[model samples]
Target: MDTQCGDLSAQSISNNYSTTAPPEPVHSTGAHRTEGDENAGGFGELTELPIEINERRPTCLCCGRPQKVCLCPFMPVRPLEVSTCLYIVQHPAEESRVLRTVPLLAACLPPEKCKVFVGRRFNEERNPELAAVCRDPKTLVLYPGSDAENLEDMKVDFSASVHNVLIIDGTWSQAKDMFHRNALFRLPKQVQLNSSISSQYVIRTQPTNTCLSTLECAAITLSIMEKNKAIEELLLRPLRALCSFQLQHGAQVHHSKEHLLRNGIYDKPMPTNKRKIKRMEQLVSNSTL
Candidate 1:
């Protein structure tokens, strides 16, 4: 996903810790020695030039944000205990986004409760664990489609056993590509959240008004699985703080593309592709209805 605040390009933080050795000092040869060195009766040794250090903005180890705008304070004092496990199948691009919400979602939950896998392809041979989870009857994939069951209306017995929830963290197009490419995703029970609430991730533009961020999706899924509404609010605390901080720091509030199109306020150029043009027309028609 290319989610970010203020149109900032994606920033990557290197995890490698290998230290580079300083370069060897240059020694003056007899032929290259200056006249001053001859007058001093000794070879003038060049002082070692100081190595330039690459200075980066100080970042918080926990939330992965700059220290000055750390979101740790907004996180829960302790990890929230939950029976439902979240498996976030993230796109490779999301790992480089600076203002992603996945970190916030993970920070609010127990380490084991939230597992992230980064890749576009998954199979039983290479991803046995994920494959097993997908085969389990208790597993549910949060994806929207004509066949997907509504999460709000689905009935499940939480007392029987914990459920595994698979969420694809990417743009709509990327997510759809992954879902279609991987047959394992179709094995799980497909589900969708039909909540009417608008997204709280004001810093990033969404495809539609009902579209939610990865964090919001997880929060709602967990709250429903655990049968506790409080989980949703707890998980969203850091996200709310993050948006508030960004808005205060000059980040504009971005409305959804659907909203802009419906109101005739969309200033961007219309798509040239016939398929895209039809999609846009459908969005405008649906919004009116």
Candidate 2:
């Protein structure tokens, strides 16, 4: 229930960003001069040499964003103290994404509370720490399936012991592949959020309306495990600010695929495979109920 992160004024937030784009490199025509040109007393023929410019934007070490769009101001001033630990199994691709949410999730929690392991494969010998956590009785994996237990229905005694929660960070397909390929992931009890809340990550499209971002999943799980409902809101404040900033800077709000299909605005081509088509139809049917 701790909410100590202070807020910044709109004017102050806007002051950090520059409206203009980076200046383009200017080309110049000049005689090429080698290292020893002056000693040789001769210059190469006139040639147009493009001035090399370091175009890489200055990045903020804390949030891993360009200085202009850094989310540090919105982030919790200090990491939240929590008993439950989060183990994020992130796909390799997620590291390269400019707008990924895993960094945001890590920023909100204490360093020891949030640990990220990046890879598609994991084994006992190679990943001893992760393997050990997977074998722990209190460990639970956040994955949705017919066999998965709803996290809300589970009985947990927070005062007696802390829990380690594992979350997969990737696209739906990537996450599914990781779960099936890694046997260690299946060692822990699988749990899913049974909330009806829609995702607030407006900059990225989700497979379904019920689908939440990696950060959102972690926020909800942490709140439930810590027995602190306010933790969810505290974790989400930065995310909401990020999305709002993106929308103001020409980013469009992305609707979920399910929402697009239901509203008859889905522009993508239908699958040619009959089974795929049937599955899509079933999804559309279920959305109505």
Candidate 3:
């Protein structure tokens, strides 16, 4: 994916939106020395390598910062009443990757109110409350238009406003699996999102036209239900994070001319040969994954 710029180096897409990411940690000189000897161990698999360091710091995929320093004020430390509580169900496999935005949404919505669960089996993580919500009889799910009831004809107690939306978070395939495997039919109202905006995830591909990243879909659906007023800013924050991550990772795979900063590709500053040897040796000795 690298676009050649004289020489090749991984350019991170994160920098594009990292202005909002948390600040880097400040480690003392003594901390580095103490952690050195123990760090030198085994290295073999490419997947095992710590890609999150040097090129990839432990930045929040959503906020683009170390988890400890999440500065996004919207990250819902508490449930700020925006008329809805997102039931964000995630596929466990996705937790390892940075693609999903539901976890990041925790920063915007009430951490406790915005629940997350993952697994092959649903009963494996059973909760009376979750079951109640979907089955609440009063609750409504937004599935595809064909099988779903019309949104316009939807009738709710408008005195408070219709707030419940079951957001299934993942790739299209993953979402479908949640629908079938989990007996989403039991849900109050089935929702099928008809979205115009194409997805923005660059690392992975998905079905076109009818697809959207969870964040984009969330915002669109919320905007429509709220009459395009409530919680718009909160929804947009996660959307921006996704764009930034794409830019960061895209650059990492393909170094742009302007972003070339001589990271420790070579151990020493001047000579290329000796530094190359040392870097290789260090890479070999370091414990991966």
Candidate 4:
């Protein structure tokens, strides 16, 4: 696999992500996608927003909900049973968006167990850490296959061998590109997320029934590997939080108060004044409460 694109994945910082809260989910639903909405950027607007890089809430371009509270866990978890090391190769575009679970998994997962490789091409020599695993006699990069394990049975052969699963986090097309471009897969046994779900990206739409968000994949993989239940909670929390934040923020932006109309969007520039900031924070706290 080309290692250059894979290694340089973490090229940018998540937008407005000052808090440690689990990321909110994005990717609007396809069922509700009207022609007008599709024209608004076809879910890319929701998925590509760098909402997480900043501490403020990210309003979904579709439903205007916090990416976390979009209310649809469209992405499903694809658990795999493996006997080697696991790595996730993500497309950089996935990282550019704040509501992305791929970036959060990279940030939160234990470094010793899980590793993230990002970019269009992964340069083996450029990433010594990934190279060490790639060079390992038993490393594997996961690609969807007809022979892949069935996740619905929740059957992870319960092995003692250190198994690694590399999940490519991105849209179905982008994921396919990652698969074709990388040379890292030749290292070990391959795996893929159980393809039984319709995807949980609430603000984006995917054509495949097998697609899953990055967090769901990671949560299932961890459950299979270490049998930790908290991973599920931790992984899904961000999505909800993001959804909730966006809803609140969007409401503020659309507030019918005289101040907005008089000032106009971007003209008066809503005061970032301390009092207003405090009011917004209080509102957020009260809503969550």
| Candidate 2 Cα misplacement greater than 4 A, ranges | 1-46, 49-54, 287-289
TM-score, candidate 1, is 0.81
The total of clashing pairs for model 2 equals 0
Instruction: State which candidate, 1 or 4, has the greater lDDT.
Output: 1
Against the reference, the lDDT scores of all candidates come to 0.81, 0.79, 0.50, 0.51
TM-score rank order: 1, 2, 3, 4
What does candidate 2's lDDT look like per residue over 201-270, in tens digits? Answer: 8788876776789988888888888889889998998889888988888989998777888899999998
Ranked by TM-score, the better of candidates 2 and 4 is 2
Each prediction's TM-score against the native?
Answer: 0.81, 0.80, 0.56, 0.50
Better of 2 and 3 by lDDT: 2
Worst 10 residues of 1 by lDDT: 1-10
What is the per-residue lDDT of model 3 for residues 130-225, given as tens digits with 9 covering 90 to 100? 676776665656545456765545565433744566666665456666667887534567755544454543334433323456665666666656
Give the winner by lDDT: 3 or 4. 4
Positional deviation of residue 283's Cα in model 2 after best superposition, in angstroms: 2.5
Q: How big is the positional error of residue 131 in model 2, measured in Å on the Cα after superposition?
A: 0.8
**Model 3: lowest-lDDT 10 consecutive positions:** 1-10
lDDT of 1 by residue, 137-161 (tens): 9999998888899898987776479
Q: Which should have the higher lDDT, number 1 or number 3?
A: 1
